[model samples]
Target: MSTYFISDIHGCYREFKILLKKSNFDVKKDYLWIAGDLVARGPNSLEVIRYLYSIKDRTNIVLGNHDLNLIAVYSGIKENKKENYFDDFLSSKDSDKLINWLRSQSILKINEQQKIIMIHAGISSQWDFETMKACALEIEASLLSNDYPLFLKSVFNNKINYWNSSLRKIDRLRYSVNAFTRMRYCYPNGKLNLICKKSPNVVKYPLLPWFIISNKFKEKYSVVFGHWSTLKDTRVPSAFFPLDKGCCWGGQLLMLRWEDKQYFYQSYLG
Candidate 1:
């Protein structure tokens, strides 16, 4: 039984299906770990979510920023923007079922046997495994709580853009969410730079990719993450693996077989 990791599928349902068929994924034996952004941007968000929902038992997903935004919009905590592509999904009869299941997903997962960590985005350089797990659990609890809508509403307004163990309540949760779902570049001191979305080569110095600046946990565990599609080429950090190949942006969708570290790709045809 193999375990495959993929990320940033956006809404390319056809490509998702093709990739699965090409890989000959066996649902009963092999497991799938999605780094997230399972929907949005492409043409078939509704179908994509429905397909994933059908295979929920065999799939492990960590929520990405777009997925969280979908929840916020569904919960009436945020306004849906026209540029965002989920109208079909929102109008579908199974919308509620899909949204609820997506919300129930986690922001981080750890495979101790493989010595790997899966997150939608990078974790803070300052946090160790225990602290990262604790912070993630705090947000997970809030998302699963009865007042989750309230939590979503509060998360966006707080400007606590850095990680601090002393941060309490909403501020703490918001920081954790951003780090796990939206982070790319951050200062060496663990202060996040949320606006720079360009490739790391073009990004000015002093602002480093989270993986490069994150020293405390460097080389400690293998990290598989998505969210920054602009990162085209892979790195040799030995611990950092970025799988978002920008399939929704006319690039290829990538999957990594964790056991052998081999990659498979499907080009965007939509």
Candidate 2:
């Protein structure tokens, strides 16, 4: 059985199926790792979640920014005031189960045997695997616990990027969520620059992508991540990689065979 890693599906259920087929996925024999963003931005999110949930035992998913956004919108963390593109997921026949499944996913998946590191957005350099896992688990508890709605609502409204262990849980929750999901660039002092969504090399400030800035993780592991939709088919410097090919924007969906780094891509049909 081959090991496959995918990311940033973004609710394009059709694209996902196409990629699954193109990759010749062997559900019983192969391991599938998803780097999150499994919902929102396209059509038929509920179907996507249901299908993945049905195969939960064979799947590994990390939460993407859009995935968390959908949860936030549903749980009243952020306003559902924007586009109602994912209304089907919110008003679906199985919204509860779908949301529950999404909330149950992790923010990072590491397999030392494969030497593969998976995450939605890139992890900050200051974060070693242990620190990253701690932050992710904290938010996971918030999403699954009794104060879930409160956690969701507060996760996106605060100042993201600051890292203060002395900060309250609420503030800490917001920073952790953003860094693990929404962050792109940051300063050397571990201050996040959430304003720029463009490539790291061309940023106005001298800041770099979290991984690059940290200089600690370059080539340390085979990192697989999704979320920067513009990174489709592009390779980053220092063995950094991006796999979110913007399938929701009518781009290609991508999958990587972890053992050999073999790749498969299919056009989005959403």
How would you encode candidate 1's per-residue C-alpha lDDT over 12-126 as one tens digit per residue? 9899899988887888899999998887788887888888889889998999988888899889778878756877878888898888888799989988888889999889887
TM-score of each: 0.96, 0.91
* Ten-residue region with minimum lDDT total, candidate 2: 231-240
Clashes of 2: 1
Task: Report the Cα lDDT for residue 141, model 2.
Answer: 83
Whole-model lDDT, model 2: 0.78
Q: What is residue 8's positional error in candidate 1, in angstroms? A: 0.6
Indicate the residue-level lDDT of 5 in model 2. Answer: 87
Off by over 4 Å in 1: 234-236
TM-score of candidate 2 against the unseen true structure: 0.91
Q: Write the per-residue lDDT of candidate 2 for residues 42-133, one digit (tens) a residue.
A: 77777788899988889988898888888878886677643536777777788887788788888878777766778888776667667777
Residue 115's lDDT within candidate 2 is: 69
RMSD of 1: 1.4
For model 2, which pairs clash? 77-153
